[model samples]
Target: MHIQMNDIYKAFGANQVLTGVHFDLKEGEVHALMGENGAGKSTMMNILTGLHKRDSGKIVIDGEERYFDNPKEAEKHGIAFIHQELNVWPDMTVLDNLFIGKELRSPFGLLKTKEMKALAKKQFDKLAVTIPLEKEAGLCSVGEQQMIEIAKALMTNAKVIIMDEPTAALTEREIEKLFNVINALRKEGVSIVYISHRMEEIFAICDRITVMRDGKTVDTQMVSETSFDEVVRKMVGRELTDRYPERNPNIGDTILEVKNATRQGVFEDVNFSVKSGEIVGVAGLMGAGRTEIMRALFGLDQLDSGEILINGQKASIKNPFEAVKRGIGFITEDRKNEGLVLDFSIRENMALPNLTSFSKNGFIAYKTETDFVDMLIKRLRIKTESGETSAKNLSGGNQQKVVIAKWVGIGPRVLILDEPTRGVDVGAKREIYQLMNELTDRGVAIIMVSSELPEVLGMSDRILVVHEGKISGELLKNEATQEKIMTYATGGQ
Candidate 1:
């Protein structure tokens, strides 16, 4: 074995995140770590990378027993990590970013600019990547940035590498290229620990799979010996026959419509409609205008030209406040930054959208606000000690529920959910899916934008595939399939 972890226990106060977690890795092998949100996968990675001190545990690397005080120490031992959110200098060129700390210097310790660019080009060429070494890292797309991060890790000649959801923002072709790069790394006898929620990818790329549930290792087996369903059962502890709830089948009158929507360079000539009680899913690769479309509809962005019709009446939405006033709710993808007020109490945040409804003659009524928030807390099944607790105190899944509940409190006619379940757990995902069903049954229109193909196919009554800032194809619920959606997303013939 190249690396071994034993009885790793970590906790934050009373909440034990990881309990006696054991894991092992061998050279020339790709090991996968699977778990739900808040299941301690990230915590364990942080421990390995020396970001967090474990309460108790023993970590062995290459037959040497050592403790890492920080990530620099881990790097000194040929250990590197590629996080989901990449770490790259946006303002600097590729060469500058690659040699930021350890630069190519002359004998007098003078900067060697020529050597840095040459080495950067060599690294990219070796990885079969064509990223311009002189170009600014910030100008590259997310996929290109991921490649740069991977190239940076490989530059260290690290023996052990850990990647966390590296393909979360990549397209199908980009993902395939990443898998090829990983295979090349494995051929070089490097040990890799891959973490992701996509089961298909785990089975396709990993040599060994380890399932973790509620902070403990449940099982670890060779990838060839296990089936996908078996892994799902172990990870979730239940059979999830349906990823999405069944549609109501009967269609209602159109509640929201956009005609010839044009946002100049963003999206152009877009036309779509969502009926009352219908769930319309918009799927596309990253930067394919999915989120941009939603943002424009909710007035978070300016549209060069478009006509928005609400319930057969022309509506003009110039800002978010006006959007909310028109009975339209938007739950943004960036929950931490845009969806919730981290420092505010849950009760206070929940009353933000419709605070006027809780006020009498401009005077707020605390008792009435508390009562309504209490009801929302119960209805959403939010796992929190009290409504007065800060939003940051809750887990990711619970915080997401609070965001949804906050929008639901406004009693919206049309809901636009952008990656509503992006970082949430499986159980929380099921709850959110069921909540969507309940809302549609009550005659609410939902326009959802998600990167997960299964979710888009399962939950939507209709699917619209956007490509290069335009609607490439549209499919009814029965006609939508993963392969078909992917074809449209990539501009397939």
Candidate 2:
């Protein structure tokens, strides 16, 4: 489908999200929508998919002006949106999720189970996905769930597909599979609106790129005509110095140590220690027990047998509260669900973990709380109208900053960051790296878990590669390379 949105304008009460934005998608072309979070990329796509009504705009589809009443209507018109957040029903079976509202039924009103399964299997095969149709959707790994979402969109026979951060959770192999499917779809005349912060993927897959900044279209150029530096400059409205900040390590004694940790069928025999003023990076594939170990360390999951030491002393942490009390803070990879409460204001989310510090005499100190929130907002460069604005309203990058700010408020001695810069733009990513450097400079130990290889190499003083729930190998900053890390991550000696 050929789609064009011209002069789009949208607002929520006082905040203007999209202002005179222009975007277009040609048939069979993968068009990249690049921008910083809160720069109106998602907002413009939401308008295109009918999730949000534009106050004023002209949506011309195939030379005819059109507007969809809702997302279902948009889908019916051959436009499918696979959001960054997978909308899978946890308890439902994969088959059920695949055919949720548009299930096939017989003339007698009975379910067409065989037909649905056959159709789902066909789609799965096309995408190189191996998830069992009978399994519960919730049991799937994040990468598997991402593939399911992609397959679901493909099942619709969509002429246009808007994929928001489609490969954020995917591993290298899975991403290759997804790229293959995308290439096949393009050959079959399916246009794609690919929205992502990953520049590598954009240049690798997209044919053209549209850059947005602060709710307006800055420029649109062919992928071959534009450079990464040029696109980034347009998106952030500034020339970013470097992708990562310089790190000068000041090593100190061990601050947190996990000795022989085991979580049964999940992860086993994990041994690692992070020293004060050091950033220890954990590298692994999506399901290599990286997140599981972090979850256990944060007391969100039980380690059947393990020892957690803080400052050379054994620590007992039975829950998140206990973990926090022990001066450990975690920024989870799944920010929407695990990191921040979506409905709460930015201030409320930031202050959630540090209530004791902001309270006095069994009463909340309003002035102190406000002051803290404001300071972090400015410090983190969080783009929001006010701290009182609901967290759900901020862009994904800003939401991540809120999560980081929340943990920073607790003043942790050992900070655990899982996918700290996932979905964050290049500019914001550098800012987060700077923040990490600042934290370590203050004698705070950090354990950073990331899927991005450059990030693992760039920010870490030491790298620990995980394979099959164990620390396969360790590499120092001067010795670690992408090839070595991958070799260790994949169970290489």
List per-prediction Cα lDDT, in the order shown.
0.85, 0.93
Task: Give the number of the best model, judged by lDDT.
Answer: 2
The digit string of per-residue lDDT tens for model 2 on 1-493 reads 8999999999989899889999989999999998998899888888888889999989999999999888999999999999987799989999999989999999999999999999999999887788999999989988888888888889899999999999889888789999999999999999999999999999999999999999999998899998989998898888988888899989899999999999999999999999999999999988999999999999999989989999989988889999999999999988888899999999999999999998889999999999999999999999998999999988888999999999999999999999998889888999999999999999999999999999999999999999999999999999999999999989888
- Please give the range of 10 consecutive residues that has the lowest summed lDDT in model 1: 242-251
Can you write out model 1's per-residue Cα lDDT over 326-445, one digit (the tens) per residue? Answer: 999999876766899999999988999979999999899989999999999998777666899899867566778889999988989999998888656565687789999888888899
TM-score of each: 0.88, 0.99
Q: Candidate 2's error at 24, in angstroms? A: 1.5
Off by over 4 Å in 1: 86-100, 103-114, 121-148, 340-354, 357-402
- Candidate 1 TM-score, C-alpha based: 0.88
Assess candidate 1 and give its lDDT: 0.85
Instruction: For residue 353, give model 1's deviation from the true position in Å.
Output: 3.4
Residue 75, candidate 1: Cα error in Å is 2.1
